[model samples]
Target: MLVTALTKLLNIRIPIIQGGMQWVGLPQLAAAVSNSGGLGILTALTQPDPNALRLAIRETRKLTPKPFGVNITLLPTINPPDYEGYARAALEEGVMIFETAGNNPAHLVKSFKDHGCIVIHKCTNIRHAKSAARLGVDVLSIDGFECAGHGGEEDIGGLVLLAKAAQELDIPYIASGGIATGRGLAAALALGAAGANIGTRFLCTVESPIHQSIKDKIVASKEQDTVHIFRTLRNTARVYRNTVSEQVIALESLPGGARFDELRDLVSGQRGRRVFETGDPDYGIWSAGVALGLINDCPTCEELLRRMEREAEEAIKGMAELVQG
Candidate 1:
């Protein structure tokens, strides 16, 4: 019942959002979220071509009539990923929600707006959220320091980040980062967020396409098991402390600084694809949030949502009872 502008814009039953993970957030995962009453977003960069994206979209429609979205990140241009084409592909696929991170997104807002897509820009700072609101995005995803990928230079936590966004922006915002359970959902609402957008929790769901070994790791991992990378580039991503991630961090910290391209082989998309596709954790990039400690099982999307709603509601009620006492 906690409907926001985003829920209305995307016609989803719940204000919750499932983030777009590179290898994990495909049509199957996205549709599962949508059908389970949350807004599921497809990671457009995962698709090799526009045709593949279109096919994926079609496949999702077959699974669920509920709404879903497409995520197109604005990268730092170290690689030659065609961002605009991804946006265009989403539009051609009749995407309802167009989410962009890592850029100003003014042009994306205009283009997607013209094509009748609801733009939800991910922001890590109040100024960024204000800018996105001014650009006419329908919703803002307020990412905090606890977020999995690139929490930005500000380092605002979800609480302060949402307060700032709520103070300045007219559009509704979803609190990202550090949110894992129903109690976290209640906390987000208390922090001035209309809803929550979760990544790590959804990643471990049964409907998610990632390998069981990966899900098991997330379920068993503790908060300390995660670490950050690329913080120097303001593109910091939180990933599990696996062998490959450890090596990457070690190489980055070396004194006589090596070239960025030297480690370029470390961050290869091909390497990531192979690892995520196969169950090979030794050589893969498993980006996740510290909330991995909180998740303990791989439930279906419906079961997860039900459990979250129950836990969140009960937590809020308990708090209310405490006040009454």
Candidate 2:
């Protein structure tokens, strides 16, 4: 009943989006969220190859017939995978929704649009959001500095970021970063966002592929438990406060500072992936937002979305009463 542009656009029952988390956005989790009436997204790059991505898409389809999407983040890596190959695989599988992020997404936007796929580009600032809008993306997922991964160096929080994007962009945008609860969803709607793009909260869900220990850590965390690292490298990422993340911060804090190469081993994506399977938070640097502190329990995707929808309705009704009082 909390219908909005996002719900209409994505053809979902609610306007909640499970942010495409790397490694964690597996078929099981994505299918659960989609089956629960929210837009679940699979991280396309999680697959080892394009053929593997197609298999993952097929697996997700087997789990749920609801609308879901694939996230193809275009970030800088020393050995980047074939992004075009992944996109082509998804397109061939009849995927019509895509969530793109990192670096300039104009090329991917044009490609997805040409194939008639709805592209939702994630941006950390209004400038990027506007640029993506002009690039013909269908929607913008506006992430603020509170976001977990690659929050950019702007230091803007979701409040100002969402409102500014609403004021500036013609394309409807979702408010991301530090968004978790029903109150958060209601706030995003009040701030002129079509919905809330949630990452950390979804990581704590039962369907999330992360280790149970990691989910427990997120549940026990506080809002201030996260720290931003790699600002010196201009590839800032907000992660849970752990020994490894702290170590990265310390190295970056040195007088001369450490280069990305020096920190590469400790922050490698492979190590981080292993952490999800091995139940070791300090195994490597992983992406987690300040919203982890907001998570207190691990609910099934169906239960979580339903509760959020109820909470949003109550919040909206409360606001209406205040206005009519």
TM-scores for all candidates: the values are 0.94, 0.98
- The alpha-carbon root-mean-square deviation between model 1 and the true structure, to one decimal in Å, is 1.8
Looking at candidate 2, the ten consecutive residues that score lowest on lDDT are: 316-325
Compute the lDDT for candidate 2.
Answer: 0.90
Error of 1 at 262 (Å): 1.9
Which candidate gets the maximum TM-score versus the true structure?
2
Tell me each candidate's RMSD, in Å, in order. Answer: 1.8, 1.0
In Å, residue 215's CA in model 1 sits off its true spot by 0.8
lDDT (Cα, tens digit) per residue for candidate 2, span 11-38:
9998988999999889999999999999
Best by lDDT: 2
